[model samples]
Target: MGFESVPSLPLEGLETVDAARRPVPASPGTTTTPGAADRAALRTDSARANGAATASPAPPDLKVVPLPVRRAEPGRDTPAAGRSSIIVLLQQVQEQHGYLPRPEVVRCAGEAGISVAQAYGVASFYNFFKLTPPGQHTIRICQGTACHVQGAQGLLERVQSELGIQPGETTPDGLFSLETVACLGACSMSPAVVIDGEVFGRVTSRQVPRILARYRRRK
Candidate 1:
């Protein structure tokens, strides 16, 4: 579903930042914590409960087993195949899957000869890699010092209201995502927003609707 823009309140006076002073985000890790453990716990508990309730013979106990390093098949090769580094393996995985699919990550562990837990740890440690699939469009709001002084905060709130989702969340239908960046290096475009890589400079809360509507129309 698309979002409807709320009427913007006026910012009396604010100064926009210059592009020259903007800094590169350089946020390589852009990492987030994974909920694999929680999922596993829930699965295990449900399985245990189900087993106890059944009158039939219970299944054998589950055991933790280390996965052996195996060559990835012809169509399943990790990027930089010959490398054994976990980081390299994950990079390859992210390159292919966009986000780290749990099954693909497990397969990666098998190919890299590392435990699944170890691979997940590595992926979760970095911020740049995403653990979940992203939406069709990505919207980045710059919240740098200059932009903030220019009322970037209100811009952010407007975005949140329009999207009906927080920075890390995707809409129910996965149409769009909202995220904040320290800077997009377009300080001159202070109070700027980037949607699908197109920068909108000198943006005001009032202009958000027109800019966002352009994308909504695409749907």
Candidate 2:
């Protein structure tokens, strides 16, 4: 089955949360960036925090994650940790763990002085928060007016067949994920797909298999 299209979210600054009991904060703007390597580190942290070990060829070892340098805007002061609101704290959690893992949510809820239900409510209210871990690759198919008229849905089906997973689903091996966006704003390039931050415009369904193979070979 094909996946329904949803609106796309632009990259923006994550909100802050009220600090209590030393709530752990997220690294700055880590969630929405093109820094794949950095995201990989956060995924590692998230996996470890959730007590799930990534089955890799090498034996797992304790590692230290280097913190990114915090940059200040020209005039605006960044919200200080503990002074920010719940949104920012949730952003931190998502940044650290890829998505808001249930256990971390409970912990943050307790620290934020809110119930677990309230926390889930807040997380659900925002389209930005993902409740589950994403695949190693995130593929966004454009289903905007132009793309749809240009046969974007067919492209989506081709991807579905190639991955054997529908949109909003990750492959069983956790290698690829599919999602449909209302528009990528690349109207000129009607049939468009973005794989792992690389935009392939004017894409055709025939190209889907080759594109997926390239990614598979990459990592």
Candidate 3:
């Protein structure tokens, strides 16, 4: 089954807790809703300051994730980490892991001093974030004007037949997920298909089988 859509959240800034014993202060314009974990992070910080034992931060081997841009709405709060900062964090997580896990969302939200609801909201608002696990290969077909003129229709059909899945759907084997994009900003490469970020321009129906074969072998 397809993933459930993410819920909407208040556009708010990240939450900040004092590393020192100072009560966790919410930076101006930041909305703070202290969760049990947030309180725990604070306790951990205090313990470490007082020479009590605490687990070291997660290893540096953490993955990079790609996050979405925060749209500035009238009611949105500005986080101390700022919108750009959170987006950068999300991007780093996605880049390293290929998908954003719920804990990462909570971690990122906590780091930003934002609530889990806000973090999940931001992650879900953009198409870039994959709350659900994705296939090994992500196939993006261009539906842009130039591509459309250059026989993207045929390419789409070929993709459907080859993968036995439509756009926005993943293969039964979970090897690939097909997506239609308006523009990949590669107008010169109209009728293009991107398999795992490698663009194949001027794709034709004849080439679809070969391309599918190429990806299927990786499975």
For 1-219, candidate 3 gives per-residue lDDT tens digits of 123454554344433343334465668986555564586677678778989676444213233344455543323445533444456678889988877888897777766666778777677677777776678899999888899999998899988998888776677788998888888878898888899988899999999989988988988
What are the TM-scores, per candidate, against the unseen true structure? 0.56, 0.56, 0.52
Q: Scored by Cα lDDT, where does model 3 land?
A: 0.73
User: Model 2, residue 69: what's the lDDT?
Assistant: 32
Provide the lowest-lDDT 10-residue window in model 3. Answer: 58-67
For candidate 1, the 10 contiguous residues with the lowest summed lDDT are: 1-10
How do the residues 1-219 of candidate 1 rate in per-residue lDDT, one tens digit apiece?
Answer: 122243342221233444324454568975433464355556667777788553333233343344555444433544333224556677887888778889988877776666688678767766556787888899988888878888898998988888898876778878887878878888887888889999888789888878778888888
Residue lDDT tens for model 2, 68-182: 4333232253323222244666899999988899999887766555567867877876657777788999999998889999999999999999899887778888899788887
List the global CA lDDT of all models.
0.70, 0.72, 0.73
TM-score of 2: 0.56
Candidate 2, residue 89: Cα displacement in angstroms equals 2.2
Off by over 4 Å in 3: 1-85, 161-169, 182-189, 197-199
How many residue pairs clash per model?
A: 12, 9, 20
Greater TM-score among 1 and 3 belongs to 1
